[model samples]
Target: MTTDSKRKGIRLPRPLAIFVWAYMVWNLLPVVAAMAFSFNATRSRSQWQGFSTQWWSGTPLSLFDNEEYTAALKHSLELAAMTTVISTVLGTLLALVVTRIRGVAKRPVNFILMIPIVTPELILAVGLYLSLTFITVWPFSVVELGTPAQVVGQVTYTVGFVVVIIRGRIAVLGDGLEAAARDLGAGPIAALVLVLFRLLMPAVLVGAMISFAFSIDNFVITQYLSSDSSTVSIPMYLYTNARGGNTTPALNALATVLVVTTLLAVALASLLYRWATRRESVASDVTGTVALSA
Candidate 1:
């Protein structure tokens, strides 16, 4: 049977499908409602006062026009970008090194790397807060509780995710490609850059996107490390203003910006991943064909 026909034949029960849809609606309904209200002409978050873009752009209280909200959004994007780059690079290197370690050291090194993944975010934040405050060494002293500390805390939290994603890709790929590159007279670093890194591009892209998403959504670490208004992120801003009596749909507009940006980053990364994987598959098939011909 055709794959589509087979899938239809094995379709889930009506009750299961209903439950799945219900669960999705249960979770997404509120989010959809909130987003819908972002365009409300009035300040009421609950009562829809007709659609308007004033919250987004027109007035002084709008998302872009308001200095405080604009600053927070800008800071959030900056933090996410910095954290994504730093975490992806560091995590990719750590994953490669950890994957190659021999006998006794491998297990311990891997366990250490995974500690941040399993640790609670609050705990990590608190630890970072203490470390940045008390540690008086050159590096620690230089890192005050602000953007620098926020970036460090976020990188510490996000690097684990990158390591996990890249290591899984590395495991699937194995060392054959790198070995082949070396056999072709490429140096170690050359083989790694040209062969392994090229193959790992999809995973790296995914890791960076995930890091960006997490950093944007992260509240506890960012809050703990924030020095003042300058370090306020979207999540922190949302938390502070979400329940205020004077709050407007502008808050929701800010939230929509965060959600849209994250979704765009993920969607773009997914597209790049698909394209990279397709190219890798084509290259592998062509290489195999040439080898067989030889």
Candidate 2:
């Protein structure tokens, strides 16, 4: 029998497919509802009166027209941008070092790097909060509880994610390419920069996108580190109004924007990863052809 015929004989039950579909709808239905409500003409999120852009940009009560909402959104974007750049750079360097170095200290170094990844966010937030408050050192003293502290806190948790991603990429690429570059008379730094880093660009981009998403969605750390109203992110603002039950549909509009932005970042990362992998394959094929010809 053909592979398709054999698989058809052993196919999953109809109920299983129905269950999976149901589960997806259960998970995504709320998000779809929220996005839909953002454009509702009426104030009630529970009941959609009619389709309108009032919450988004229709008038005085729209998200764009509201100063507080606009400010919070701007602050979130800034924090995400700063966190992505810093964490990606530091994390990429750490990954390269960890992958190259070999010693008794490697395990300890790796364990230290992973602590934030598995630790509770609340604990990490509190620890960061206390350090910034009591640690009267040169940089710590200067780092007051505000946007600066928020950025640092976000970076602390996010750098590990970047490290994990780039490290996985490094593990896959192996040492063969770097060794070949060195054999071609390239110095260590030159090989790393020109060969390894170029190949690792997709993973780096993925890490940056992940860091940006995490930073933008972070609430606990931002809340603990925020000094004033100026440092309030979208999540913090949403929490404040949401708890009070006085929020308008404009809040939904704001949430939709956040959802769309995060989805876009993730989509872009996937596209870039595919492109990078394709380019790498082409380069490898060319190199192999040259070697065979020689």
- State in Å the error of residue 83, model 1: 0.6
Candidate lDDT values, in order: 0.92, 0.92
TM-score of each: 0.92, 0.91
Candidate 1 shows a clash count of: 0
Q: Which stretches of candidate 1 lie over 4 Å from their true place?
A: 1-10, 280-294
lDDT string, candidate 2, 1-294, tens digits:
333354477656999989989999999899889889998988887797999998888588899999999999999999999999999999999999998778999999999999999999999999999999999998889998999999999999999999999999999999999999999999999999999999999999999999998999889999999999999999999888865566789998888888888888888888889887986777866776678677
What value of lDDT does candidate 1 attain over all alpha carbons?
0.92
Give per-residue CA lDDT, model 1, range 186-219, as digits (tens): 9999999999998899999999999998999899
